[model samples]
Target: MAFDSLSAFLAMGGHGVYVWAAWGVTGLLLVGVVIHARAERRALLRDLRRRARRAQYHGASGAAAPPISHQEGRARES
Candidate 1:
């Protein structure tokens, strides 16, 4: 409504370049954040799965050592 026509709206009284550039940069950054988050999530899940498999393999073979509690560790250190 404020703009008379499509071309005039796009021109934005000669300030369109700056306004559109800002919008483009903001959009790109938002997209990059989304992509990075997804990649991190996938890597975390893959690492967890790998750890689980390793634990399972060790446990099945009776080679996995039992986890020590903090108290036990301190006693051993002393």
Candidate 2:
């Protein structure tokens, strides 16, 4: 082993603090990214499901839902 002991390996020749801090920050950021991505995916799926239900309801009534682009344009104008 390059390090004589476990303590020495962890200490990293007096640079342990900086090295460990960097590793901790990297781990935290990776976890945050995964969590954010999952939340975004869930939100997108929920929005899609809601839109499908709305379309089905409108179709059953023989009324067509407005095109997404037109709705978006009207919303923007408002």
Candidate 3:
């Protein structure tokens, strides 16, 4: 089919409202999902790096307490 004008092309035989609305909402949500996923990935990576740094610092500082066995812990407590 051919349209005499741009308005006629958009009208789409009176079903344009439903069609355009669906397309617009779906496009918007898809973009929002991409943005949200990127943000979550960055935040999680930052937290992981921070935890790793703390662990490295503690290991290098040599002030970390030593682990004790269960029997040793009971003997110490007694």
Candidate 4:
């Protein structure tokens, strides 16, 4: 089938409302997914950068971070 004009093509045999609504919903959902993915990626990158800065700061301070165990602390002290 061929459309005689742009309006007729969009009308889609008088089901234009339902067809356009479905298309609009699908487009909006796709855009939402893209936005969510970008936000998550940015948050992950920011966390990674913050962690790197903390590690660098600790290294530059010249005192090693203490061990987590009491036994290790006692042995080091001895």
Candidate 5:
């Protein structure tokens, strides 16, 4: 199929509104997915870094201690 002109093709036989709306939704969804993936990756890396630091500290001290948990702190208070 050939359009009479670029503008005519964009009009898409009077269905351009639906076509553009669908494209807009798809673009926004893709952007949201990319943002979420990046955020999750950053959080995972941060957690790994924290664990590595804790392990290194224990190794240097030559003492193996259980990980300190927030619950443990609260239990100590009680």
Candidate 6:
């Protein structure tokens, strides 16, 4: 099927209202999802950077981080 004119194409055989509304809602939802994901990723990265900074500060101060438990570390040679 071919649309011979722009107005007829937009009218979409008189079902344009439903079709256009569905398209608009889908576009809005897609945009919202993208924005939400970007925000979440930024927040997670910021938290990671903050922790890295804290670790560096502690290292520079010559403060030792807590040692891993022996059981969680290397096993002793039998």
TM-score leader: 4
Candidate 1: deviation at residue 37, Å? 1.5
TM-score of each: 0.61, 0.59, 0.55, 0.62, 0.53, 0.58
- Which is better, 4 or 5, measured by TM-score? 4
Better of 3 and 6 by lDDT: 6
lDDT of 2 by residue, 1-78 (tens): 889999998999999999999999999999999999999789668756776797787676424543335443356322
> How much is the lDDT of residue 7 in candidate 6?
94
Backbone steric clashes in candidate 2, count: 0
Model 3 lDDT per residue over 6-68, tens place: 788788779889888999999999999999999978966875566567668777643353333
**Relative to the true structure, how large is the alpha-carbon lDDT of every model?**
0.75, 0.76, 0.71, 0.74, 0.75, 0.73
Stretches off by above 4 angstroms in model 4 are 60-78
Scored by lDDT, model 2 comes in at: 0.76
Worst 10 residues of 5 by lDDT: 61-70
Displacement of residue 30 (Cα, Å) in model 3 is 1.6
TM-score of 1: 0.61
**What lDDT score is found at residue 39 in candidate 3?**
90
lDDT of 6 by residue, 1-78 (tens): 578799998999999999899999999999999999999789668755665687887776423434334562254221
Error of 2 at 5 (Å): 3.5
Q: Which ten residues in a row have the lowest lDDT in candidate 2?
A: 61-70
Backbone clashes for every candidate come to: 0, 0, 0, 0, 0, 0
Per-residue CA lDDT of candidate 5, range 1-78, in tens? 688988988998999999989998999999999999999789668755776787787676424534445563455323
Runs in model 3 deviating more than 4 A are 1-5, 60-78
Error of 4 at 54 (Å): 2.3
TM match of model 3 to true structure: 0.55
